[model samples]
Target: MNILLDAAQTAARLPWAPLVDEIEALLTDPTVQVPPRTVLPMAAGAFLFAMPGCDARTAMTKLITFTPANVGTATPTIQGDVAVFDVASGARTLILDGPTVTGRRTAAVSALGARWLAPNLAGPMLIVGAGVQGQAHVEVFAAALGVKQFRIASRRRASAEALAAHARRLGLRAEVVDDADAALADCPLVATCTPASAVVLRGQPRDDAFIAAVGAFTPQMVELAPELCRAIAAQGRIVVDSRDAGHEAGDLLQAGLDVDAMPALADIVAGQPKARDARGPVLFKSCGWAGWDLAAARLAAKSRPTG
Candidate 1:
């Protein structure tokens, strides 16, 4: 059965605010064989996938976030769908609204990252890029961490300020800044929210700066320095949402990061390994796992009154 969910209705009933605990508990006791995202280039755009074996349910999705060149027209920033299956029966169960699910689940994943790794995460959070992912980051982090100060930076000052203004309207202390450096300096939990294939952020943190680089999916297209692999190699443990992403994610391989050292988010949450090294400066390279999306969505479904 292919049951489709209304984006608006599903989003409203997202249960995103309450899904954090389930996501955390999942990190502690995982039931899926999560694979890092895969990519297949299409003529118009490309498809990225994160397959979770059994995360409350068996789910796999191909998130097709398009190239910015296409955005010149009215092409959506991200558009895709998720196909969920039954573990025991191997029957197709649900086909979710991919584009909406991607934004919400990805945001939840980053929020979970902030909840577990960001140490002493007080004050100003700087989010680069004011796209769907960028906006989602702000929503998740604000809900996860009781942050007081927030700043949004985009290539366009108007858009950045708009996001800031939105946050403030939501009762969050925030503002939009034209300078990226100032945002990084003010906020300890700095995020790389852009997907552009270049080094973003004014610079990495001075010390113990927690970064969740949600941008930069391919090695050719990276948001931070290729030397970041070396930076984390030296200073802190470079943890990933999933090690499988290391192979699929260009940022890590391009940075000359070794997969052997990369730890899974589950391990960090499970106490299999410590969140950060004694030195500090922890890094989380997120390719946006399917497991997280499925995890968040599955839990959300449980909250609804099923027929």
Candidate 2:
């Protein structure tokens, strides 16, 4: 039997701390399997993606489409479904709203990245882009890493203000800043969640800061500047969610980075040593991977009601 979960139900089942811990276990586990994803480009700025993975016990896949034109309409930019299956019986178990799985799992993965890269980060952190990913990240960071102060920025004042207001209701200190640079000025950590085709921030991040760039999955979109990429790469501290990021992440491509030279998040989580410039910032470029979806889907499936 297949269980179905709407976005609200999916979100309700995933609490940040345990969900983040599950992500951490997946990232650090050497046995988790994530195959290369498939992307099919469609005309007029739309693309279809299929991502599949397994956690030894269960298999799952996330099938999604990105349509840029949806932004102006009432539809969401990302739409699709995630299917979870029993490994032994090969029975379909659950189907979840793709956007909710994507948003929550992505933010959980980013939170894990921060823990591995900068475990001691106390906020006044800056989150650039006040959309769904932005709000999710704020909640994840606060819950997973104990970051309580945030500076939220968006091209529009209202959007930033809305996110900041939400943050304040959590008893956290949050402010909307007009200048992106000023918002990031003394931040120990920063999350760039925009879908800009060009670079968003103008200057380099603080030397001690760690950056999580969760946007810009396509080669055409770039959120981080090349100079910032170069500065972090110089320290040999760049990491990505998956090896496939070499093909999908625009921020890394725009930086002229050799994806092969960057370590996968799993490696970092497993305590594998990579070149590290101790004084430079660490960069975590996430091009959403299949394994995360699988893990999340399994968790959601386990929460299903039983007769």
Find the candidate with the highest lDDT and give its number. Answer: 2
Question: Over the stretch 1-307, how does candidate 1's per-residue lDDT look in tens digits?
Answer: 2267656645653555666666776666546656655566656445444444465455555455555565425777676666666666777766677777777777777777767777657867888888777787788777767776777888878778788888888789887877776566567787777866566653556466677887766556677677765676687667787765666556677777776467777777877454544466767788766667767556645556233
> Candidate 1: which pairs clash?
219-250
TM-score of 1: 0.86
lDDT of 1: 0.68
- Each prediction's whole-model lDDT (CA): 0.68, 0.83
RMSD for all candidates, in order, please. Answer: 3.2, 2.5
Task: Please estimate how well model 2 matches the true structure, expressed as its whole-model Cα lDDT.
Answer: 0.83
- Taking the candidates one at a time, how many backbone clashes does each contain? 1, 0
Q: Can you tell me which runs of candidate 2 are displaced by over 4 Å?
A: 272-277, 304-307
lDDT of 2 by residue, 1-307 (tens): 4378788877766778778888877766666788888999999889999998987678888999988878636899999998888888898887889999999999998888888786338878899999889999999999988999999988878889999999999999999887777656678789998876668875767777878898889887889888878877886378898888888888889778898778888777677453333567788899888988877876776663322
